[model samples]
Target chain A: MPNCRTVVPFSGTPEQEQKLREVIARYKGTQGPLMPILHEAQDIYGYLPEEVQATISEELDIPLAEIYGVSTFYSRFSLNPKGEVKVSVCLGTACYVKGAADVLAEVEAQLGCKAGSVTSDGKFSIDADRCVGACGLAPIMIVNGDVYGHMTVDRVAGILDSYRGEVE
Target chain B: MSENMINLKIDGVSVEVPAGSTVLQAALAAGVRIPTLCYMKDANELGSCRICVVEIKGGRGLAAACVYPAADGMEVFTNTEKVRASRRQTLELILSNHRMECPTCERNGDCELRRLAADMGIDSIRYEVEDLEPQLDESAPHLVRDNSKCILCRRCVAVCRKNQQVGVISAADRGFATHIESAFGRGLGEVSCVYCGQCVAACPTGALTLKRSIDAVRAAIDDPSKHVVVVPAPAVRVGLGDRFGMPVGESVQGKMVAALRRLGFDKVFDVDWAADVTIMEEGTELVGRIKAGEKMPMFTSCCPGWIKYMEHYHADMLDNLSSCRSPQQMMGGLVKTYYAEREGIAPEDIVVVSIMPCTAKKFEVSREEQRLENGCMPVDYSLTTRELSDMIAGAGIMFGLLPDEAFDPVLGDSTGAAVIFGASGGVMEAALRTAAVVLAGDDADVPLVFEDVRGMEGVKEAEYEVGGVKLRTCTVSGLANAEKVIRAMEAGEAAYDFIEVMACPGGCVNGAGQPMHSPFERMMTDVKGERAAGLYALDDSMPRRRSHENPEVKALYAEYLGEPCGHKAHHILHTEYVPRDTYNV
Candidate 1:
């Protein structure tokens, strides 16, 4: 009964499709190619849509169920498109013990979007990562590529305000 | 012992098994019991569920008996203190997350997990299940999926991908969120699921089960205005007895008829009669196609699973399929049309229910093409063998002691060719038996038995010269074998004049709607072979061995329909197909 929490509309362009097909053709015959092809497709499309999964299923002759299974198994692969400003809160053991869940909750309230989904305006997204390997900076939050160590609930809105003004 | 045998000591008993055998196999060889939850012989061996964990001497911890190989001088202890605790702990953890509604579960009495828990004497669950919110999926016509009862064994997934080769269902997501689902969380009906129900059969718990029609059938029977007529498919005759405490491979045709009569049906008939009629129409079509050289191979359309698979996967070769309705649908159409007229009952007033060994028949009965011109389906309710057995038990009818009763004379009589339609090569063999005589002009010598296409092999191929016509034929059970044949034909490596495909292994006798057996019994016993043998035995006992020889079928053709494949017969007994997308959602 596990289902997709949020599914963004598939907006892959013709150029992106052509690039995906090329990537599929390059790795069609390689042993265990679904993983590599999925990774590349995710990179090209920013996320794996049902339409993109169907294309891969047809080109590789693999069942779409299997492709979807592999895509969902790895946390690296995203099913929904990431927003322009991606916010990731590490919920690994170290981060959780130091109150990362509060940070994640604040982000969700500020962005008006749940974890693993984009905001209504498609400008902000939040995800709970397992571990970012920064235990020394427990309770860490990453915005785009920039990491904030020892993050607090009160500081979450201030950091988002700084990016909100820049994006608008 | 053979040179390749491995020496092992299981529970202090010296056992010698094949080198490639696992610790479970070695223990079984030495008469040791090792309970398993996620192990289905030749189908699933994930060892994900550690219910089969056993202690090995000189090893650090308990190892899974299903995957742990038996080596020379290996000491395997199946029931040691450590093994017992580990298995008990594993079961407890699985049960912690699993929905414990055994009283109302479909597989209450036959559940493997429940049986194991009782055997291990686990009275209570220590941990509470975090709200998983496992949803019930009743999207498909044939199967219902309840993730609440799923133990994440993946047996259904393995069987779907490996045994059936359909691969419609798979384990999506990971960890606690992992659940079996179709692509993109689409419903099974929304996807290209053929509704074969093999996954239902592979499920160890109440996670998967056929969509029941027992209540609808009961309602139709209770309505005084309606006249309900029941027709059981050929395979049900041989497979239904398995639920009645009868021995496996026992054909209780008379008892089945008696039970249906006791179930308040207005008439109890046999689908085998319609199977004979199918041979007449399909045989004529096959001969015409061969004579005109229209298509290379004419695939049989009796199996709804195979039909849907063709429609989904091999739509381009749809023309290659014989347009004849399956025996069940043929019988239903005839009951609503010919029998209804004969009895002076309106087609709308008469309810046609098919008792089948297949779950796919439920979907088949709901098809738009199967509906009459009056906008009513020929078959009202298609009930599985298991459903019928449950209804019989629920009605307080002692099936074992019921007197053997013959089917009503209206649509009861059939020939030997009709009975064998339960097996894999049955339809092909039945067609050949009649086609030989049709091509050679009836009174000419023809072979009654086509031994080449008989037995329980996944795929069988044969070449025969009938009436100076050299015909290459292929008979396949299991969609995987069908896929292989199609791929071979596409590659120009193989050619055939006729092909018969049954999606279930060993044909309808091993259908998903038939009796459920434990993994041990399934691995040890040849259920498919035994059930098919029962049909073949019944076929051998019949005096008339061919379809054309069925007196009732010939009487119908002479009385109403002018001839086989005639315009009127075509209107009722034939149908068309359309291509379907695999991912319709």
Candidate 2:
């Protein structure tokens, strides 16, 4: 499966709302459409807010609880808005064995944010991953899709500084 | 042997089963026990657990007996070494991820997983257990969810989605991270949960249990200045003996009363008496609606689960719901006001505790609309039959040995119609007994039993004659069925003067807070049917079969209140509804 771009929150503009409506219109009647609709919805809106899910639920006639269930069940979906610089520390089995927990702690301390949460300014967000499939490069971390292999706890500070003005 | 009957052999024992029957069904019929975790017989047969796996001759791998069909001359080995090994591995995998908090768990002795583990003689886990971050959800009033105790059987999810049509919970995440939760990973109390606790009843482990009110009752009971009056629902008696070693459908109302008396309740009353009063107010409301031609189909407002479902999904039909409080709430209101005033005790001094066949009652009493002006809760603490049974045993009372005793006189008298409120179509039947008489007036001889509405069909519609007017009624139990009836009503395909809806299938007899059916009990007996029949038997044995004929209700109205649905009854027994968004978070 190709990587789906899951960043870029909705500006709450009319165009984004229309795009969301079109996504719901395209997938409403398909068999088991909630997951797909949610996937597309997350793409259209960056993350599923209560309002986005409510729109899909209204269009598809699916219960909101069910849509929420499908949305939460898949780790790929995010309920909160993503920060400009999305930092993910791979806690996959290989990474954990190679001191990924220390790397995660370093990332959180430097970015001042925990997994699944955005920083106060919303410029930096952090999360953990299962595997980036780069197990050979154990203890790998990603900042805005830029992979840093063999990451040490000490090297985390340098990585954040590298991405510091790259937000624009 | 019929032509459709297929012959099968299980461990060299020959058995004949219907052609379409599953191997599990045939084995069960042959008195063979195969353990199951995810399988809930007909309700949920997902076959995900793999605990009920059996070796099929000439098959490549082990077959899940729950879903595998039995073939003619099929040889199945259930207790073989390979089958046992596979079952053990499956259980071990489940156990590895499970929290293993059996000692302090809520469902310690009553859990299916704990029983299976003990039966298999699992001394120690062979696999590495997952170190999980414990999550506690007390969002809803009646239920608590512990993801650590969950085995991902999906039983609760299936029951919630398929049976109730209120899928407030679903299988979230995947693999080791998989656990059941509400949409968007929000707390259940934050969502549109109906607080039905069907998931709690369907759970095989302590993953789900009630938000208990035992401690509050104990505190009230220990307070010398306070008078805690207890009222048990009609269905409580039929299923109370289930947790004890007694047979299913055992009549333990008398012993239940005796047990409550010994538990230090100042007054042990019957909620059925309030059920009779419900019939008076609700029946009067039906008569008024029929006569006024307002709100074409007046729905019964008895089931809190159904009411919450309406607030979320069918808020437009709020006008159709009868404005009367449920029997539990009605009894609560009366106990704090009428009963307290009669006994010369201050309403504040009276702590009303209700023992019910529903977990939703706990949520119901706490509802803002059900509280009085001075902030005194009508029913202070609501306990399920299961909770009450546990309390009785905890107090060292020998339930079976206790002699039969009657309830205290003030609020104890109940007729047959009141008692049948525990079963599906019962409220309709009970309401009909009084409504017809009120509507018929001179020609008020209605039949004691309305057989058309008295069965286990998902939705039953019946019409009866009252004087020259015809009264159409629809009775439904499960919320799924309730949806169908509402849809039909919307489409103008059916119309009714009155409609009764019970959130649990088979009504309170199969309530979520009632004694649950273990997988063994599910196989052994028709738990709902047996309990419903016991209620009907009690209904038959009573001399007065009509709610209006209850002498106590008659005297209460004659003495305290002027008439049913009068100014005083409206203030004490009526309620309002508000529309809410399905997803709050």
Query: Which candidate comes out best when scored by TM-score?
Result: 1
Poorly placed runs, candidate 1 (over 4 Å): A1-6, A102-114, A119-121, A131-168, B131-134
In candidate 1, which residue pairs get closer than 3 Å at backbone N, Cα or C atoms, i.e. clash?
none
Model 2: per-residue Cα lDDT over A1-168, one tens digit each:
011222334357688899989887887777887877788877887778767877887788776667766676577887667788888889999999999999998888887666766766778888888888999999999988889999999999988998887874
Tens-place lDDT per residue, model 2, B1-585, is: 899999999988999989999999999878898888899876799888899999999998999999999999999999999998898888888899888878888899789998998888788888989887667888888898999888888888878888888777777655656677877567888888788888898999999988888988999999999999999999999999998877887778889999999999999999999999999999888888888999868999999999999998899999999999999999989988888888888999899999988988988888887777546889989999988998998999988899999999979999999888999999999998887777767424656679999977779988888666798889999998898888887898988888999999889988999877786677788888888888899999899888888898998899897899999888889999879877763
The lDDT per prediction is: 0.89, 0.86
Correct interface contacts retained, every candidate: 0.69, 0.57
Tell me the deviation in Å of residue A65 in model 1. 0.8
User: Each model's TM-score, in the order given?
Assistant: 0.95, 0.94
Q: For candidate 2, what is the DockQ-based docking class? A: acceptable
Per-prediction interface RMSD in Å: 2.9, 6.0
| B1-585: candidate 1 lDDT, tens digit per residue | 789988989989998899999999999999877899899988898788999998899998889999998999998888878888888888889998988788988999789989989999999877785565557999899988999989989999888888777898888988888888898777888888899999998899999988898998899999999999999999998888888889887899989999999899999989999999999999999999998999768999999999999999989999999999999888988988888888888889988999999999989988997677656688988999999989998999999998999889968999999999999999999999998887788746789999999889999999998888999999999998899999999999999999999999999999998989888887778998999999999999999989999989988998888888998788789999979877773
For DockQ, the strongest prediction is 1
In model 2, the Cα lDDT at residue B149 comes to 87
DockQ (Cα-based) per candidate?
0.55, 0.44
